[model samples]
Target: MKRIFKFIENNFFVIVILFVAITLLYPNIFSWVLGKVHGINIMNLLLSIILFGMGTTLKFENFTEVFKKPKEIGVGLIAQYMIMPLLALTLAYIFKLDTALTAGLILVGTVPGGTASDVITFLAKGDLALSVSLTAISTVISPLLTPLITVLLIGNHIHFNPIEMFISIVQIVLIPIILGLLVNYKFPDFTENLKDYLPAVSSIVICLIIGGVLGANINSIYTASWIILVVIILQYFIGVALGFVVGYLSGMKMKQITTVAIELGFQNSGLSTSLAKTHFPNYPIATVPGALYSVWQNLAGSILAYLFRKYLNKEE
Candidate 1:
């Protein structure tokens, strides 16, 4: 049982891909499940659960570390907020994507760093503390930054009410995370005991979210699969490259560069998907880029981490 759980934790991206494929090929399965709970904001609920689990993994020390190394964290935050959104907007325009696809790609760009970046940093033998700090800070401020950037970048093309977005982010992300942190602080022992299970829980919820999004947009996905895939792939690699450049030019160490690269490259796509579903229901297809991105970034991040690990090992 333990090994099975471990396997699921380690191979989460694979599991996500399998489920997405299954959902796409047989949308009825998920659509039926979704229909059973019609009128419920399922994505919002799942995102809150995921954010709560993320909060449990965090410690107060993580926030203090941000002040301890403000420069590193600042560089990471700037790179994360700047590079990806610009790259996404540029790519969306260059690709001449329709409004929904353009908004989807840009939405993926505007969100915060994924919690998965911390794990990828550890796997790559990079700066885990820096990764964690970046993720924490970015996520904490996502409610503000995500909406602001989304509005600035694509507001003319899409109907986005930043105020509504702010409210949603607060409700779905900030509140739950704060609750989780409080639980962790108050019951350290209990939280620690359950820590190992959190990843599996998060993985399951994320996969289900992806499945739901894919299932909801199966017909549109069939038509725009290739183009959207290409745009998302470009968005990921460009963010990675620019992250490294920003880190190096800012005088960060190689490991810090690796950490920032991962952070910048991996947006909180689950958040994007959730926000898309909740706020942009009129454009269900807009969630597709984020859903697809959720799968591709993990694969790309893992491969990059492995290569970085091998190269770092050689240097050491």
Candidate 2:
């Protein structure tokens, strides 16, 4: 049973793709997961659980890496915020996306790095400390930066309140993470015991979240897939490529380059989906890109990790 769970966690990108296929073919299968539970969204709750799990693995010392490796972390921070959002904005304009998708894509760009990036970085034999630090710093700051940037990018076109979005992020992203950190702080042994299993659990929940949204938006998938699919590949893969370029140009080492590339490529897409549901009530399609990205980025990152392990590692 433990081996089964470990396999699921390690091969989560495969699991995500399987669930997405099942959801797309039979939306009813996972459509049930998309509804409300006592007026709280199941998707939002599931996403919060994922964030909480992330918080558990983190320690306060993670932030201290910021000071210790300022140049690397600083470069990552600037590139994370600047590269993706600008790529998203440029893609949105080039594709002439609707307000819903424009907002969704930009949100995917603006939010923090994903915990999955740490796994990818590990697989690529990159600097895990730098990856974790980037994720931790970005997650801590996301409540402010995510909403502020989303509104800044899309406010003129969309009329959602940034304050409300900010509050929602704090509720959905920040609070759960803090609670998880507190639980880990207070009950270190318990969290340590669950560490191996949490990734698998989080993977399943993420699959469900993606499945549910895709299930719910079955109609939009056919139409949106045509354009958004192309945009997703471009934005995420280009982000990864350019991130590597950024690292090289910054004179970073090979391991640091791999970490930077992965961090920039993977976004905290679940947060983006939850925020879209809370704020873009009218544009249900806004949640689609996040769901799509939740799958595509992991798949891309995994494949990239393989290339790094195979080709790039030899160079080092």
Candidate 3:
């Protein structure tokens, strides 16, 4: 058991890769698991558990980093909002994707930096604190900003009740995250010990979630395969380029640049998927980009983190 835990801890990225591979090979297993777990909103439960663990990791000080370095945070935020929506619009125009997919791609771009970015930033020897602050602020602001951005960019493409989206965000995104934050604040050591365990749990559940979504819509892959791959590739390069350019232009260090890159590249596609299901049920394909995104972003992020670490070491 100890060895298993340690193996998961040491090779979390490899585990994610393996999970993706398994899901691709045995896509039906996701449906099997979901069917067996009747009466459970497996996706929500997984997200709640993930957020609960995240809360334990939070510190009040992490939130304060924004106030101290407003400029850095501001630049990061600008890059996030700009790169995502613009890329989505451009890609949608170039490919002439359906409204649902266009909206999904836009939402993926608009959602802020997630907790996973913080882990990758740390792994890449980047600005861990800055990444944490950006992630916290982004998550906190997402309930408002994400919906507003979605409406502004894709409102014409779909019938979006902004009020409904707001409610969904509160139920799915805000409440769970806040509860997790409070849990961590009240019990520091307990949260710390559980940190190593939570990622593995979240990871396995995320894999399941991805597999379930893919299996359900395996048919979409036939027509949208090229489109999905294009969005994934474009989103990644744009994210990395935006991060590097913005960080350099803002006079940040190499480590800070890497942090920004990862933060921009890795999003909370899970959160976006939940939001789409709850509020944009009419546009089911809107969740596809995010679902496939969960798989692609992790693959790219792991490679980028490895490269950044090696490059940083060489420079040092």
Candidate 4:
């Protein structure tokens, strides 16, 4: 059982794609999670579970890692925020996406680097401390930055209230992370024991979120999928390319460059979907990009990790 769970955790990209395909083909199976009873989505609850699990992996030492090399962390955070969000806005206009799709893509851009990124960083032999620091700091500040960036990018294309969105992120993201951090901090021995299980649990939760999004918007996605798919893939590749260039220009080490590139390339798609669904319930299509992105980024990141491990890490 442990080995099976570890395999699922290690091969998360496969599990994610498989689950999303299931929901997209047979919406009824996972669509039930999308159904809101008294205005609460079981899907969002699943998202919280993932976020909390992410927190358990973190330690206060990870936060202190920021001070050890402030420049790399700064470069990573700047690259993280500037590269993806701007590209998302640009692609939204280039594709001439409608309001709902535009909003969804924008949300995808603005969220922080996810825990999957840390895993990819580890896999690629990148600077793991820098990756964890960036993920930690970006996630901590997301409640403020996410909504602010969303307002700047999406603007009038989507009806947005930063305050409402702020509260939603706080509830859906920040709180769960805090609780998980507390659990880890207060019960280090306990957290260590569960560390192996966390990846398996988180993989399942991410799939459920992906499944819910695909199931809910299966019809719209079938008809209108190509452009956003292009946009999401572009957003990732562009961020990665820009991350390498910027890291190189900034004189980051090869490992740091790979770390920055990976961090810039992936966003918190679960949080993006939760925000889209919670705040834009009327625009069901608004959650589509985040869902699709959730699938594509993992696949892309895994492939990237392999290439980086094979080629880039050899340089170090």
Question: Each prediction's TM-score against the native?
Answer: 0.95, 0.96, 0.91, 0.96
Tens-digit lDDT string for candidate 4 (1-316): 7898899988888898789768867887877777777888777788778888878878888888778888988888877777788888899889899889988988888999988889999999999888888999899889999999889877666776899999878887889988999999999899898887988998888888888788878889988988889988999899889999999999988999999999988899888888898888778899999989888989999899999999989766
* lDDT (tens digit, per residue) of candidate 3 on 1-316: 6466667756765776676567668767676533325665567667767766766777788778978988888888888887767877888888888887887888888887767888788778888889988888787788788889889998887887888777766666678778878877787777887776787777776776777777666777757888788877887778788889889899988888788888898888887776776667777667788878887787777778788989863474
Runs with alpha carbons beyond 4 Å of true place in candidate 3: 17-26, 32-40, 312-316
Better of 3 and 4 by TM-score: 4
lDDT of each: 0.85, 0.89, 0.77, 0.87
Rank all candidate structures by their lDDT, best first, as comma-separated numbers: 2, 4, 1, 3
| lDDT by residue (tens digit), candidate 1, 45-127 | 77788888888878889889878888899888888888888898999889899988888888899999998998899998889
Clashes of 2: 0
Question: Highest lDDT, which number?
Answer: 2
lDDT of 2 by residue, 1-316 (tens): 7898899988887898799788867888987666888998888788888889888988888889988999999999999988999899999999999889999999999999989999999899899999999998998888888878877888899889888888877877889888888899999999998897999998999898898889888898787788999998899989999999999999999999999999999998988887887789899999999989988888888888889978776565
The positional error of residue 2 in candidate 4, measured at the CA in angstroms, is 1.4
Q: List the RMSD of every prediction in angstroms.
A: 1.7, 1.3, 2.3, 1.4
